[model samples]
Target: MHFNFPRTLGQEDAKKRLSAALASGRFPHALLVHGEPGLGQLALLLDLAQILSCEDTATKPCGTCFPCRAFDASALETLHHLIPIVKNDRNSGSDDDEEAGPESGQIDELNESISLWHRHPYGYHVSEKAMVRTSQARELLGRLRFAENEGRVRVVVLPWLESLNDNSATILLKTLEEPPANVYFLIASDHRSGLMQTLLSRCLHLGLSPLSASDFRVAAETLSQRAQKPFAARLLPFAEGSPGLYVELLENDGEELLEEALRFLSATSDWRVFADYAAETSPGAEGMERTTRLLLFLLRMVRAYQLLKATTPANAGTRIDTAEALEQAGWDDSLAAYLGAIDAVADLQAFAAFLESAHRAVREYSKPSIALVGLFLEYEGKANRSVPA
Candidate 1:
């Protein structure tokens, strides 16, 4: 029986370590996989879950066994895959609505999400508004009440552990403290700090590093083939070391976001224009996600600008061609033009720092318009100071 792990880039060391542990029968009952998105943490957990439930011990998952087949079909009764979901108010009736569990529509959405995740674990995106509800946690506890099968292991796969609200986290903490025999919890989170310390203490933590350049290229190529699209080489620098992020940029109209970032930089000269842009771009919850993406793109651009400025003739005492720098960074013509426009007046480092802070603010659910307006105002002041009045 062969273990069927997802086709992901890099993290070979982590995988080997995990496989060894599983083989030695020393694997942790509760494992926490934490890393930046695109590092394939969820894929690792999914594979682990299958391995734990596999009826065949030699070579583990042995994808042919009934347990393995059931896992593949998402019909494994012992495998509980949990994800954050928005609660439906319409499903609420009694005061014990928390026990009512997910509505059929919600369940359908979850199943669909799981299906997509199985197909492309790295590229899958959950709704930003979705969160682990107290009711869902309660349902999980209820399911665990039944006696475990003598020889089979039950696996609870929870992704985005940081999305659990206080009540949900508290409810699950008990199970984590003393999980049923033969029950293992596999949890993944992009932001470990957002989780409770008590919860963190109960699990064996594994932190995945970013992919190397070569690994990222291979992963990108694989995903490109799967997506039936050419690799967007221009967006590679923006993705840093994350193929998941690369896939996201490829599918999420990333070029539009880049154009918007350029527009934002160009608008910084006029307060009214910048304010208008902010208001127009950030209207609501969806707008907040878009704004966050835009901010990340801008932050990357700022870093590029800093690099360019540091290597410029005036600073480095060497004539470094702007076009050469742009090409090396995989930056396009629009970005080149935007950087040139701000070259003299922008304090690249300070602006980059501000952008980073603004990004954190947006992620913490601050109003996007407010964060954008503040960012613009701050940049405007810096630009004004650099200009000759």
Candidate 2:
């Protein structure tokens, strides 16, 4: 049940701003933290809660304090956690909490998920299965109407705000309009654009940008040691300044996948091999995200190749300032030969265009393997004709 504030990594500016506000007693009643996926938005929310409710006035979240421990353990009576859940089609809006015996499974399932998140705030696995429904939002409003327990400030943390269904969002907007006294709401999300515009205006919006490479490196190293896994240092550049993403890629065998990607691109002329690679790499429901990850890596490589080729031969040795920039716009030294083999500007552009199309298709819910294979077929048709065979 221990946590640290300064150690939140890559969020010093944000931490400082919030800490100052808290110390000055001028913090907002409702706040929204938004950023790219895996930026530790939930962790930040919990940290702020612990600090705000901590007994030690000077040190703020003295992790050993009762309130701090409660927040860390997620056992604080004053804290309410609301998350997304799939509607039970079989039991339409049944009060699962009041349901008797084994029928109370929904409440138990929700608690178990919350427990996992509390134990591993950063590395917790969020299921893509459920969503926030209006019933849950109404439940939250009902809870807020009651006075705070233990005489402490009441705090509600709602992570993944965009998961709220339309009805849920509408109910949430009403609560935001007239939030209960001594009760504060903190919502975090990666999809700000999807949020209701009226809801956005009510909360103090805080934007968390991607971390710096130095911070990302430190975070990756820490997570690697904690998870007892090897860190792929080379993938740091491609992680785009998000340590969470770097850890994800490292855990999912990103190094090997990228190697396979390079090979696949080189052998694009062979339809059978391309199809096989596409099929194997296309993740099913649980890991369907692999497709998007693959497409991102491919885009980075293609873009890097294009930029490097565009630069003067003498200036090609120069380095970009940031890891993000280097990954997106610079070529890997080891891949120089492969890059040279496909250095034809027109050909690279064509390939990049098709890759873009494939990326769009995946975003639009297309079958990834099929979309990628189709792209390969199209490219191969032209490639075969252009070659004297």
Candidate 3:
């Protein structure tokens, strides 16, 4: 059926490879697509699943077929989805019970989520706390036990498979090891390391890379037009070539986050100021989400500074001499100015590492105020040691 793929950039190679495999009748029954969270892995997985279940042999997804129409309307009987959901203890029914599916409210939420994702895959966001539970896995397994039409394909699309808990993963692994006839599993994961090795071995793996700058620009521009928002090129470097992330930044207060990141850097010049800023922006449990986004912006700046230092001629002597030089190197105006003012390349490198450590710490429930204070103290110590008496 006539379907519009998400306006994600790049992955042409991946599309070609998948199409070739399908054409040759060598497509893997369980295919695992892994990449960074915003690299469009889910979008690609959905496209592949739709193509696999298409009724048209000549054109594949000939747009007018029943399967194609069903898919478009999200009513395909053979197509299924397994998405992460908030764990509900009260709804924990026996695995053997056929009626122990998600509650009607959960089902409504799931359907709405899928609908929104279909409209704008890149812009969709799943709650970090949601995960695939054992009950959901058991329900899906129950559905698969029944026989299907001969020669008809049934596709199960699972996005964020990394969210599958240990018990749920074991349930899925059993099926992946010995899947039913004419069934395909299209799985996508943002964090491959979180997945079990046994599960990894059962699927044909495809890794996707971040989009190129040109492709990112095209995707960003398209999203901007559809969103009716002004395109902010300065946020491009922060996006690190992920259109999903780019869209996220655009929709969220990305510009403000960048500005706050710059302010944090400026505060580094004075211990008292830095400490005050740290205290003010300290992400107690409630602010952790915004703090994480701010940290990403800071990390992006640090990396950009590192790249600028690495690429400049040795004669430049680790100093970004002018805004013009940074601009020439493709930095936006604000970022160029910030990079131009920095001379401590070594300190920035160390700070980048610290930022990474802090990011992990915050995600692991460490106090963000302590992390922020630690950053200031560490940088101040480095600054003091580098200066002449």
Candidate 4:
């Protein structure tokens, strides 16, 4: 199968710049590609990795080289797909979890990995890695321990950079600050808020916009011949520019409305609904996971809007009218509140970690519901908290 990097309409200009950089032989050692998911951000980076490592001297991954062949066979171990590293207790300083919930001592597991590529790639969900702990960061430093005699470039590709915790992120700071001879660091993350300012300054930043509604329509049609036009109309707006998200909605098995409602609440206060969703999600592991994801996406999108809009947040309503409702509901203060939402959403993983306690509470074996209610209250309170004095 052809590994197609489906370029969205507006992304061609960015591609042009990368092409120029390659042609001039001035490729930066590390590149930070920031964009919404579903824009083929990972695909572009993978293709770039091959192009960089490919023996063929072309602007693209010269369809002919050991690396290219390996890429085609999906056997290429060199292009390291680096995702957010979370800290897990099992990871007693091993580097395996770095790819999935990534941080430092995380080892990269090629087989049995939990991506959709194992079956229907489109259906893949990232396996949660434990939060990248300080030990994990040390594990990552271990990867660079050996020196390669060959000129092979092992590219580490992390899809979401914002997932790295403060301790884990510091490990990257050293490598990013210094230049390694052949190793390359290419990270693709949408959450700019979580990244360190000095980290942002260390690499070439490429901002990628999401796909247009029409573009997604064409993609959906191409993916499935029987796609309905009206479905695109409904889905495109919610994709929020990411074709992947649009695709996810179409495959949502009748929960599209719920997803949309969640998205709306995340973008705006919709205080009552969020409070209820949080309450509803608190009692069960599955419910909490789902609600937590909604909160995460909501925080991310709002943060994106916050950073991109040149004017006050009130003007950001031009994109999402719900933002205006939120502003009217008194959300027009510091970005700290928006950030709090991200932090709160991220804590759901902690809820997941304590699933046994939750299950006990759900079964009335323990007071899980009370604990959940407390968690939701904390989330709501944080959102309601204005910039502290």
TM-score (all chains, Cα) for each model:
0.83, 0.80, 0.89, 0.59
What is every candidate's alpha-carbon RMSD to the true fold? 3.8, 5.1, 3.1, 10.8
Better TM-score candidate (3, 4): 3
**Candidate maximizing lDDT:** 1
What is the per-residue lDDT of model 1 for residues 1-389, given as tens digits with 9 covering 90 to 100? 24446554678888888877876778898999988887888778888888888888567678889998998888999998778876676744642355567779989988888888777888877666678888888888778767554646788988788778778888888988878788899998888886789989999999999787678778877888888888876666577678888888888877787677777777665688867866776777777777778878888666656666564545463434566667655455445666665463346656777678777877775576787678768876876786578
Flag regions of model 1 displaced more than 4 Å: 1-4, 57-60, 91-96, 266-273, 279-290, 304-322, 325-345, 356-375, 386-389
What is the descending TM-score order?
A: 3, 1, 2, 4
Better of 1 and 2 by lDDT: 1
Candidate 2 lDDT over 1-389, as tens digits, reads 23247435577788777867786787888899989877778778877777767888568789778877877677888888777765566755563322222226668877887786665566654566576656677777887886744455888888778877777778888988987777778888887986789989999988888786577788878878867887666666566667667777777767875775667666665689868876776777534566666667777667545455444444454432333333444424555544443453235556777778777766676586787788878876766666566
Instruction: Estimate the TM-score for candidate 4.
Output: 0.59
Worst 10 residues of 4 by lDDT: 1-10
Q: How big is the positional error of residue 131 in model 2, measured in Å on the Cα after superposition? A: 1.1
lDDT of every model, 2 decimals: 0.76, 0.70, 0.75, 0.54
Q: How far does residue 32 in candidate 2 sit from its true spot (Å)?
A: 0.9
lDDT of 3 by residue, 1-389 (tens): 23333334577778777777887788898999888888888677767767777878677666678987888788888888888876566655642223456777778878887887767777776777677767788878778767544668899988888778788899999998878888999988887886699999999999989887777788778878877899888888778788888888899888888778767676666778856765666646657766677777778777666666666665265466546656666757666655644454346656777678767756775576777667657866876686675
Candidate 2: 10-residue stretch with minimal lDDT? 94-103
Backbone clashes in candidate 4 total: 28
What is the alpha-carbon lDDT for the whole of candidate 1?
A: 0.76
What TM-score, to 2 decimals, does candidate 2 have? 0.80
Q: Rank candidates by lDDT, best first.
A: 1, 3, 2, 4
